[model samples]
Target: MARDTGPGLARGSTARGRGATRSPGWALAVILTLICVVAGLVPGRPGTVALAVPFALLALSGRDHRTGARSGTEPLVLISTDRHLTRSTSTLRLLLTPRPKEEPTKTLAAPSLVAITLAAPGCPADGLVLQADEECPLVADIPVSGEIAVLSYGSAGVSADVVRPTDFVQAPPVRVSVLPQVGPTLARPVSRRLSGLSGSHTSRRPGEGGELRSIAPMQPGDQQRRIDWRATARRSTDQDMLMVRRTFADAEASVVLVVDRANDLPASTEDWFAAGTSTLGQGSLHVARTAAATVAASYLAAGDRVGLDDLSGTRRPLRSAAGSRQLEQIRTRLAGMSVVPRRRHRRDPVPPQGAVVIIFSAFLDEEPARLLRLWHAQGHPVIGVDCVPVLQRTESSRAQDQTVRLTLLRRRLLLEDLQTEGITVLSGSVQDEPGRQSEREHGAPLPDAAGTDLDTGLRLLARQSRRGAGLSAAPGTARGIR
Candidate 1:
């Protein structure tokens, strides 16, 4: 069965066929020259004709040169379509000039050759394949149809199409499997972890020990028992954590997602960001979605109620909480997010006080670093995920000498700058494989920590989430940028 390999994704031949026909001036100049010679040979007016003969020959010669310059000896392509079968077949053969009054014979085969076979279900029982020798010359017995499929040989990247038969219908759809990653864990503290906290302490009545006095916003390392459940429940969703001292009821933590859209970053970096925003998986939107997903997933998994504030691409922030419906809502929002240029002079709206803030971004510029400092000053435990672009240079010829050197230098400088701050930067290139070896080889350095695979980070995060440690910080702030 012949299939229509969609445009840009075809799997077969890659060369193009030759163009048809040559310039007409070559033949015309030859005929004109002959006429001038014959006129000079005539007896009547021979002297006058002789003088004109040189000029005519000169003009004819110039015309011949012009014609020859424009003429090309490329092959002619013949594409035949079987209307009944809706199949298309193309043939390529060269046309070389022959002796006078003799027919032009097909010589060389077309250079670019491609053949596609499309077969519909329950259609024809037979097919024909064409065979060619070392030199693909035109043969009188070329097979046009039969049971075997004939494919022309040529370069790896050739362009060719197979004509389908009229009786053929569209091909059937094939099933493809999408592998899943290891399931969620408790070791990683994502924004979603805050939600589960609410359910875990739901049985305890409020106002048993602490009064609802308004104090300063809560920071990391604060006691979880002091969390203002009523205020936290009202302000944020399952994706944001709420920390409070026993002294305050309305205290909340403000979380911000700072995505960097700088010129120095790699192209399609936004795509990765978008992917993370869409899901909790480790890819693009990880900055926006990962911490949020982790927090929400962890909180819900641990019975803590939490809330989420989406600052990506919105005039007004999207706010939701930790519930079955809320989780679905967060997923839907992340999935639909598109990368947008940040507006100048506008700050991301901050969540209420005591809200656990998870900042996600590539950290390509000083803006994210500055923002992290600001959030830290305000007493929020800011977890930064640095989405680093992977550099690839397979062919030395494709890159300039200076460009490659500059890239390596830039990465080093950026890593140093990120570490200077207290941010836990995870630098991973998309080009790196998902396995442990690839992660160990290309993984970014963690602050004060040894290098580890990407799976290690993810597994740790997942385990943390499953254990209700969503808000717990790693022993010391470890930063890595690969």
Candidate 2:
């Protein structure tokens, strides 16, 4: 930004800076020179001083013809950053642009020394430096780590910027936007129909995949090239008959993350922040995002297209996209995701045909379960991942607590309804802390999440889905950010 210092000259303050300082000696000398001239000009002036007094005093003054003819006292230094904002550890290029010098003039400053100092948060003393006669366009790496990395420059013994110079400025602070980073994922994938692409899944009805399915007697319409002579010879019963080989077709599958943002019992922002050090017990939104990203990463890494949508429908849905670049875009979008309040205008988007839709949710009600049924009815393979962490009873009367128990029982019954509709409720090993685990004694009792860890739950689902049947609705696990 440009700050108007005076007429014609403007000071560029990138972020923040203080006013300039002027030396007292220069002002005192100029005043004395004026006094000396006035005294000599008087007709009845003291006979002690004649015409020689005025010119002699002026010569001794700080202001000189050489200095006045110049624009400034010395070459003004301009400090600036390459970018106004950046993230952690990102390379920062600071440009120290000094006004061109015609010839070095003798000032109180020592030309042999060019002192450089920097003031910034999370910054060490060694940010950037310039030699006595260093050239321009120099590269300096600033080591930074924090939410905001401030930057300021200082030039010791340089009188040019001391007296309200307009050329000097402090660069703006760098804002670090550190989002959650997702790591490698573990997901067992399956695709029913094999198409043109070669992939891991074996298609049910196939023409050309390398994985062998079965060998059969050749019919009249069978291709002669597909004949398996060895199979015919091995089986005496079929020795006289021509045997043909059948193989599963290779095909790529698409996955859609059907994130359920309609959780009635989500962790409060205060509760989420209160357990700052707890790795497993973050907010529900965080768990949902992580689960969605995990599934996306697994499928994408397997060379499959992935898409994302919100049950709340507050934001525009992302269509199915392929390739490595899409992963970064997906991660960034997930990081900016917020817990949107339920809206009546929410519309249910349809998943692609033959695509696998993984729903991340906490089944507080039957609505999310009913949504799964719709996807299943449309011939899409659906998997439900319950992102609910272990629940703790709130303060209430016995009658109110009984109502909570009935609500939970109804929720469990709805889960069974999902299974009857062919959805696998993935029961994961989720629990409150050892101390909080016993809180269930004060509240409604719940079935133990059957598994050693969260991975065990996911692994169970992966195994169950291997048969290509409907699967998923597992309890939440503590799979850390990655």
Candidate 3:
């Protein structure tokens, strides 16, 4: 299959094979001839013999168009996707140019129309017979798989040649982003876990013009208007000690989504075709992407800087940014990952200091455990989003079932441990129901982790993480984050 880069255009030849393209005119002639023959067999129908001769002659007239194409050289096909804003579904037009007509051996040839149907690797659209000048609209379900749409074609129509040969055409695969099932807008803005220079997250830093942090003794640089006269006078005695007001600095945080694609996508029951069924099965890639996109959009909407890191190599590494374009880029990149990546574990990147990283994975492997643990040890708040399979399923025997049970037990324990370390872990299934975290999972209580609706709690956690009791900070010290 060939790949074309720009959005919505796929051009390529079919999978290699020599097949016949036959004209329908001969089939019509055969039917007429059979009718004539039947009439002649009946009593007092001698004129039917004359009619049968003409019908037989007509059957042998049209030349099939199958002469030019040879083995491994299927006909060229053009597939273009068009979006109609008013219509909910998009349309894909397949423009087929049949092999040019050869020397006409038979007179009164069939129409130049060629019938095309999907052959190996079934297509999203039903079969269509189209003229060289005309394009047919496919009954395609758009965005069938991530960004790449898979389709194959074969000749059902006869070429304008003697013997009326046929050719099966497997068109090239294309990348397309049509309708995506983006989840509902978050009920609340995502909460960030770190104190940073600037963002929508209210910071732990003490500064001017924000929610009151506390009141303290008036210092030399303290503004005169900041004096809390009521508190100062109440605390005042024979001595002249003064009091002033303090407030927190409004700041923002950075969020990075680490999407894990390094595993065999569990076979999707939905996209996977079964015996006598056409509904396609979708898999873990869809699940992972849905969770990742949702996480990115939520955090970006909360005014936190968001970046993407994919283990699957389907996307380039994106720097953290809070912009509409960033969201679009992320979505587009995610939608285009049509192929499921092979499982390959590698070293995880060390997240930048104070960045809250969300790891989206199935959590079936131990690599995520090690990676998340490393992030935690570095003091970066890590949230684990377990991307449970949506369309993909793995076959299992009794031993596999026991193994799965053991793995789940281990997974639950690992997540519980992560929570104990202050890393937030959530299930992809319950993503929309944020309240599920409040409940115990396999007897583990979540730390009210990041992205919780409780911003104040996260703010307090950020303050704790940044306050006087950290690795770089001394027992008593004053510092400012730029």
* Top-lDDT candidate index: 3
Each candidate: how many clashes?
A: 106, 2, 37
Measured by TM-score, the strongest candidate is 3
Local distance difference test values of all predictions, in order: 0.37, 0.54, 0.56
TM-score per candidate, chains pooled: 0.38, 0.51, 0.61
- How do the candidates rank by lDDT, highest first? 3, 2, 1
Q: Candidate 2: lDDT of 83?
A: 58
Question: Which digits, one per residue and each the tens of the lDDT, describe model 3 over residues 68-146?
Answer: 3334244534554434323344434433445554554353343455666653233345666676446554544444336
Which scores greater on lDDT, model 1 or model 3?
3
- Work out how many backbone clashes candidate 2 has: 2
The superposed Cα distance between candidate 2 and the true structure at residue 206, in angstroms, equals 2.2
**Alpha-carbon lDDT of model 3:** 0.56
Which scores better on TM-score, 2 or 3?
3
Model 3 stretches with alpha carbons more than 4 Å out: 1-66, 69-78, 82-111, 119-126, 130-135, 143-145, 154-157, 160-169, 178-196, 215-244, 264-282, 313-315, 338-347, 390-423, 430-482
Show the colliding residue pairs in model 2.
Answer: 426-473, 426-474
lDDT of 2 at 251: 60
The residue ranges of model 2 lying beyond 4 angstroms of the native Cα positions read 1-184, 189-196, 216-229, 232-244, 262-281, 345-347, 391-422, 427-436, 440-454, 465-482
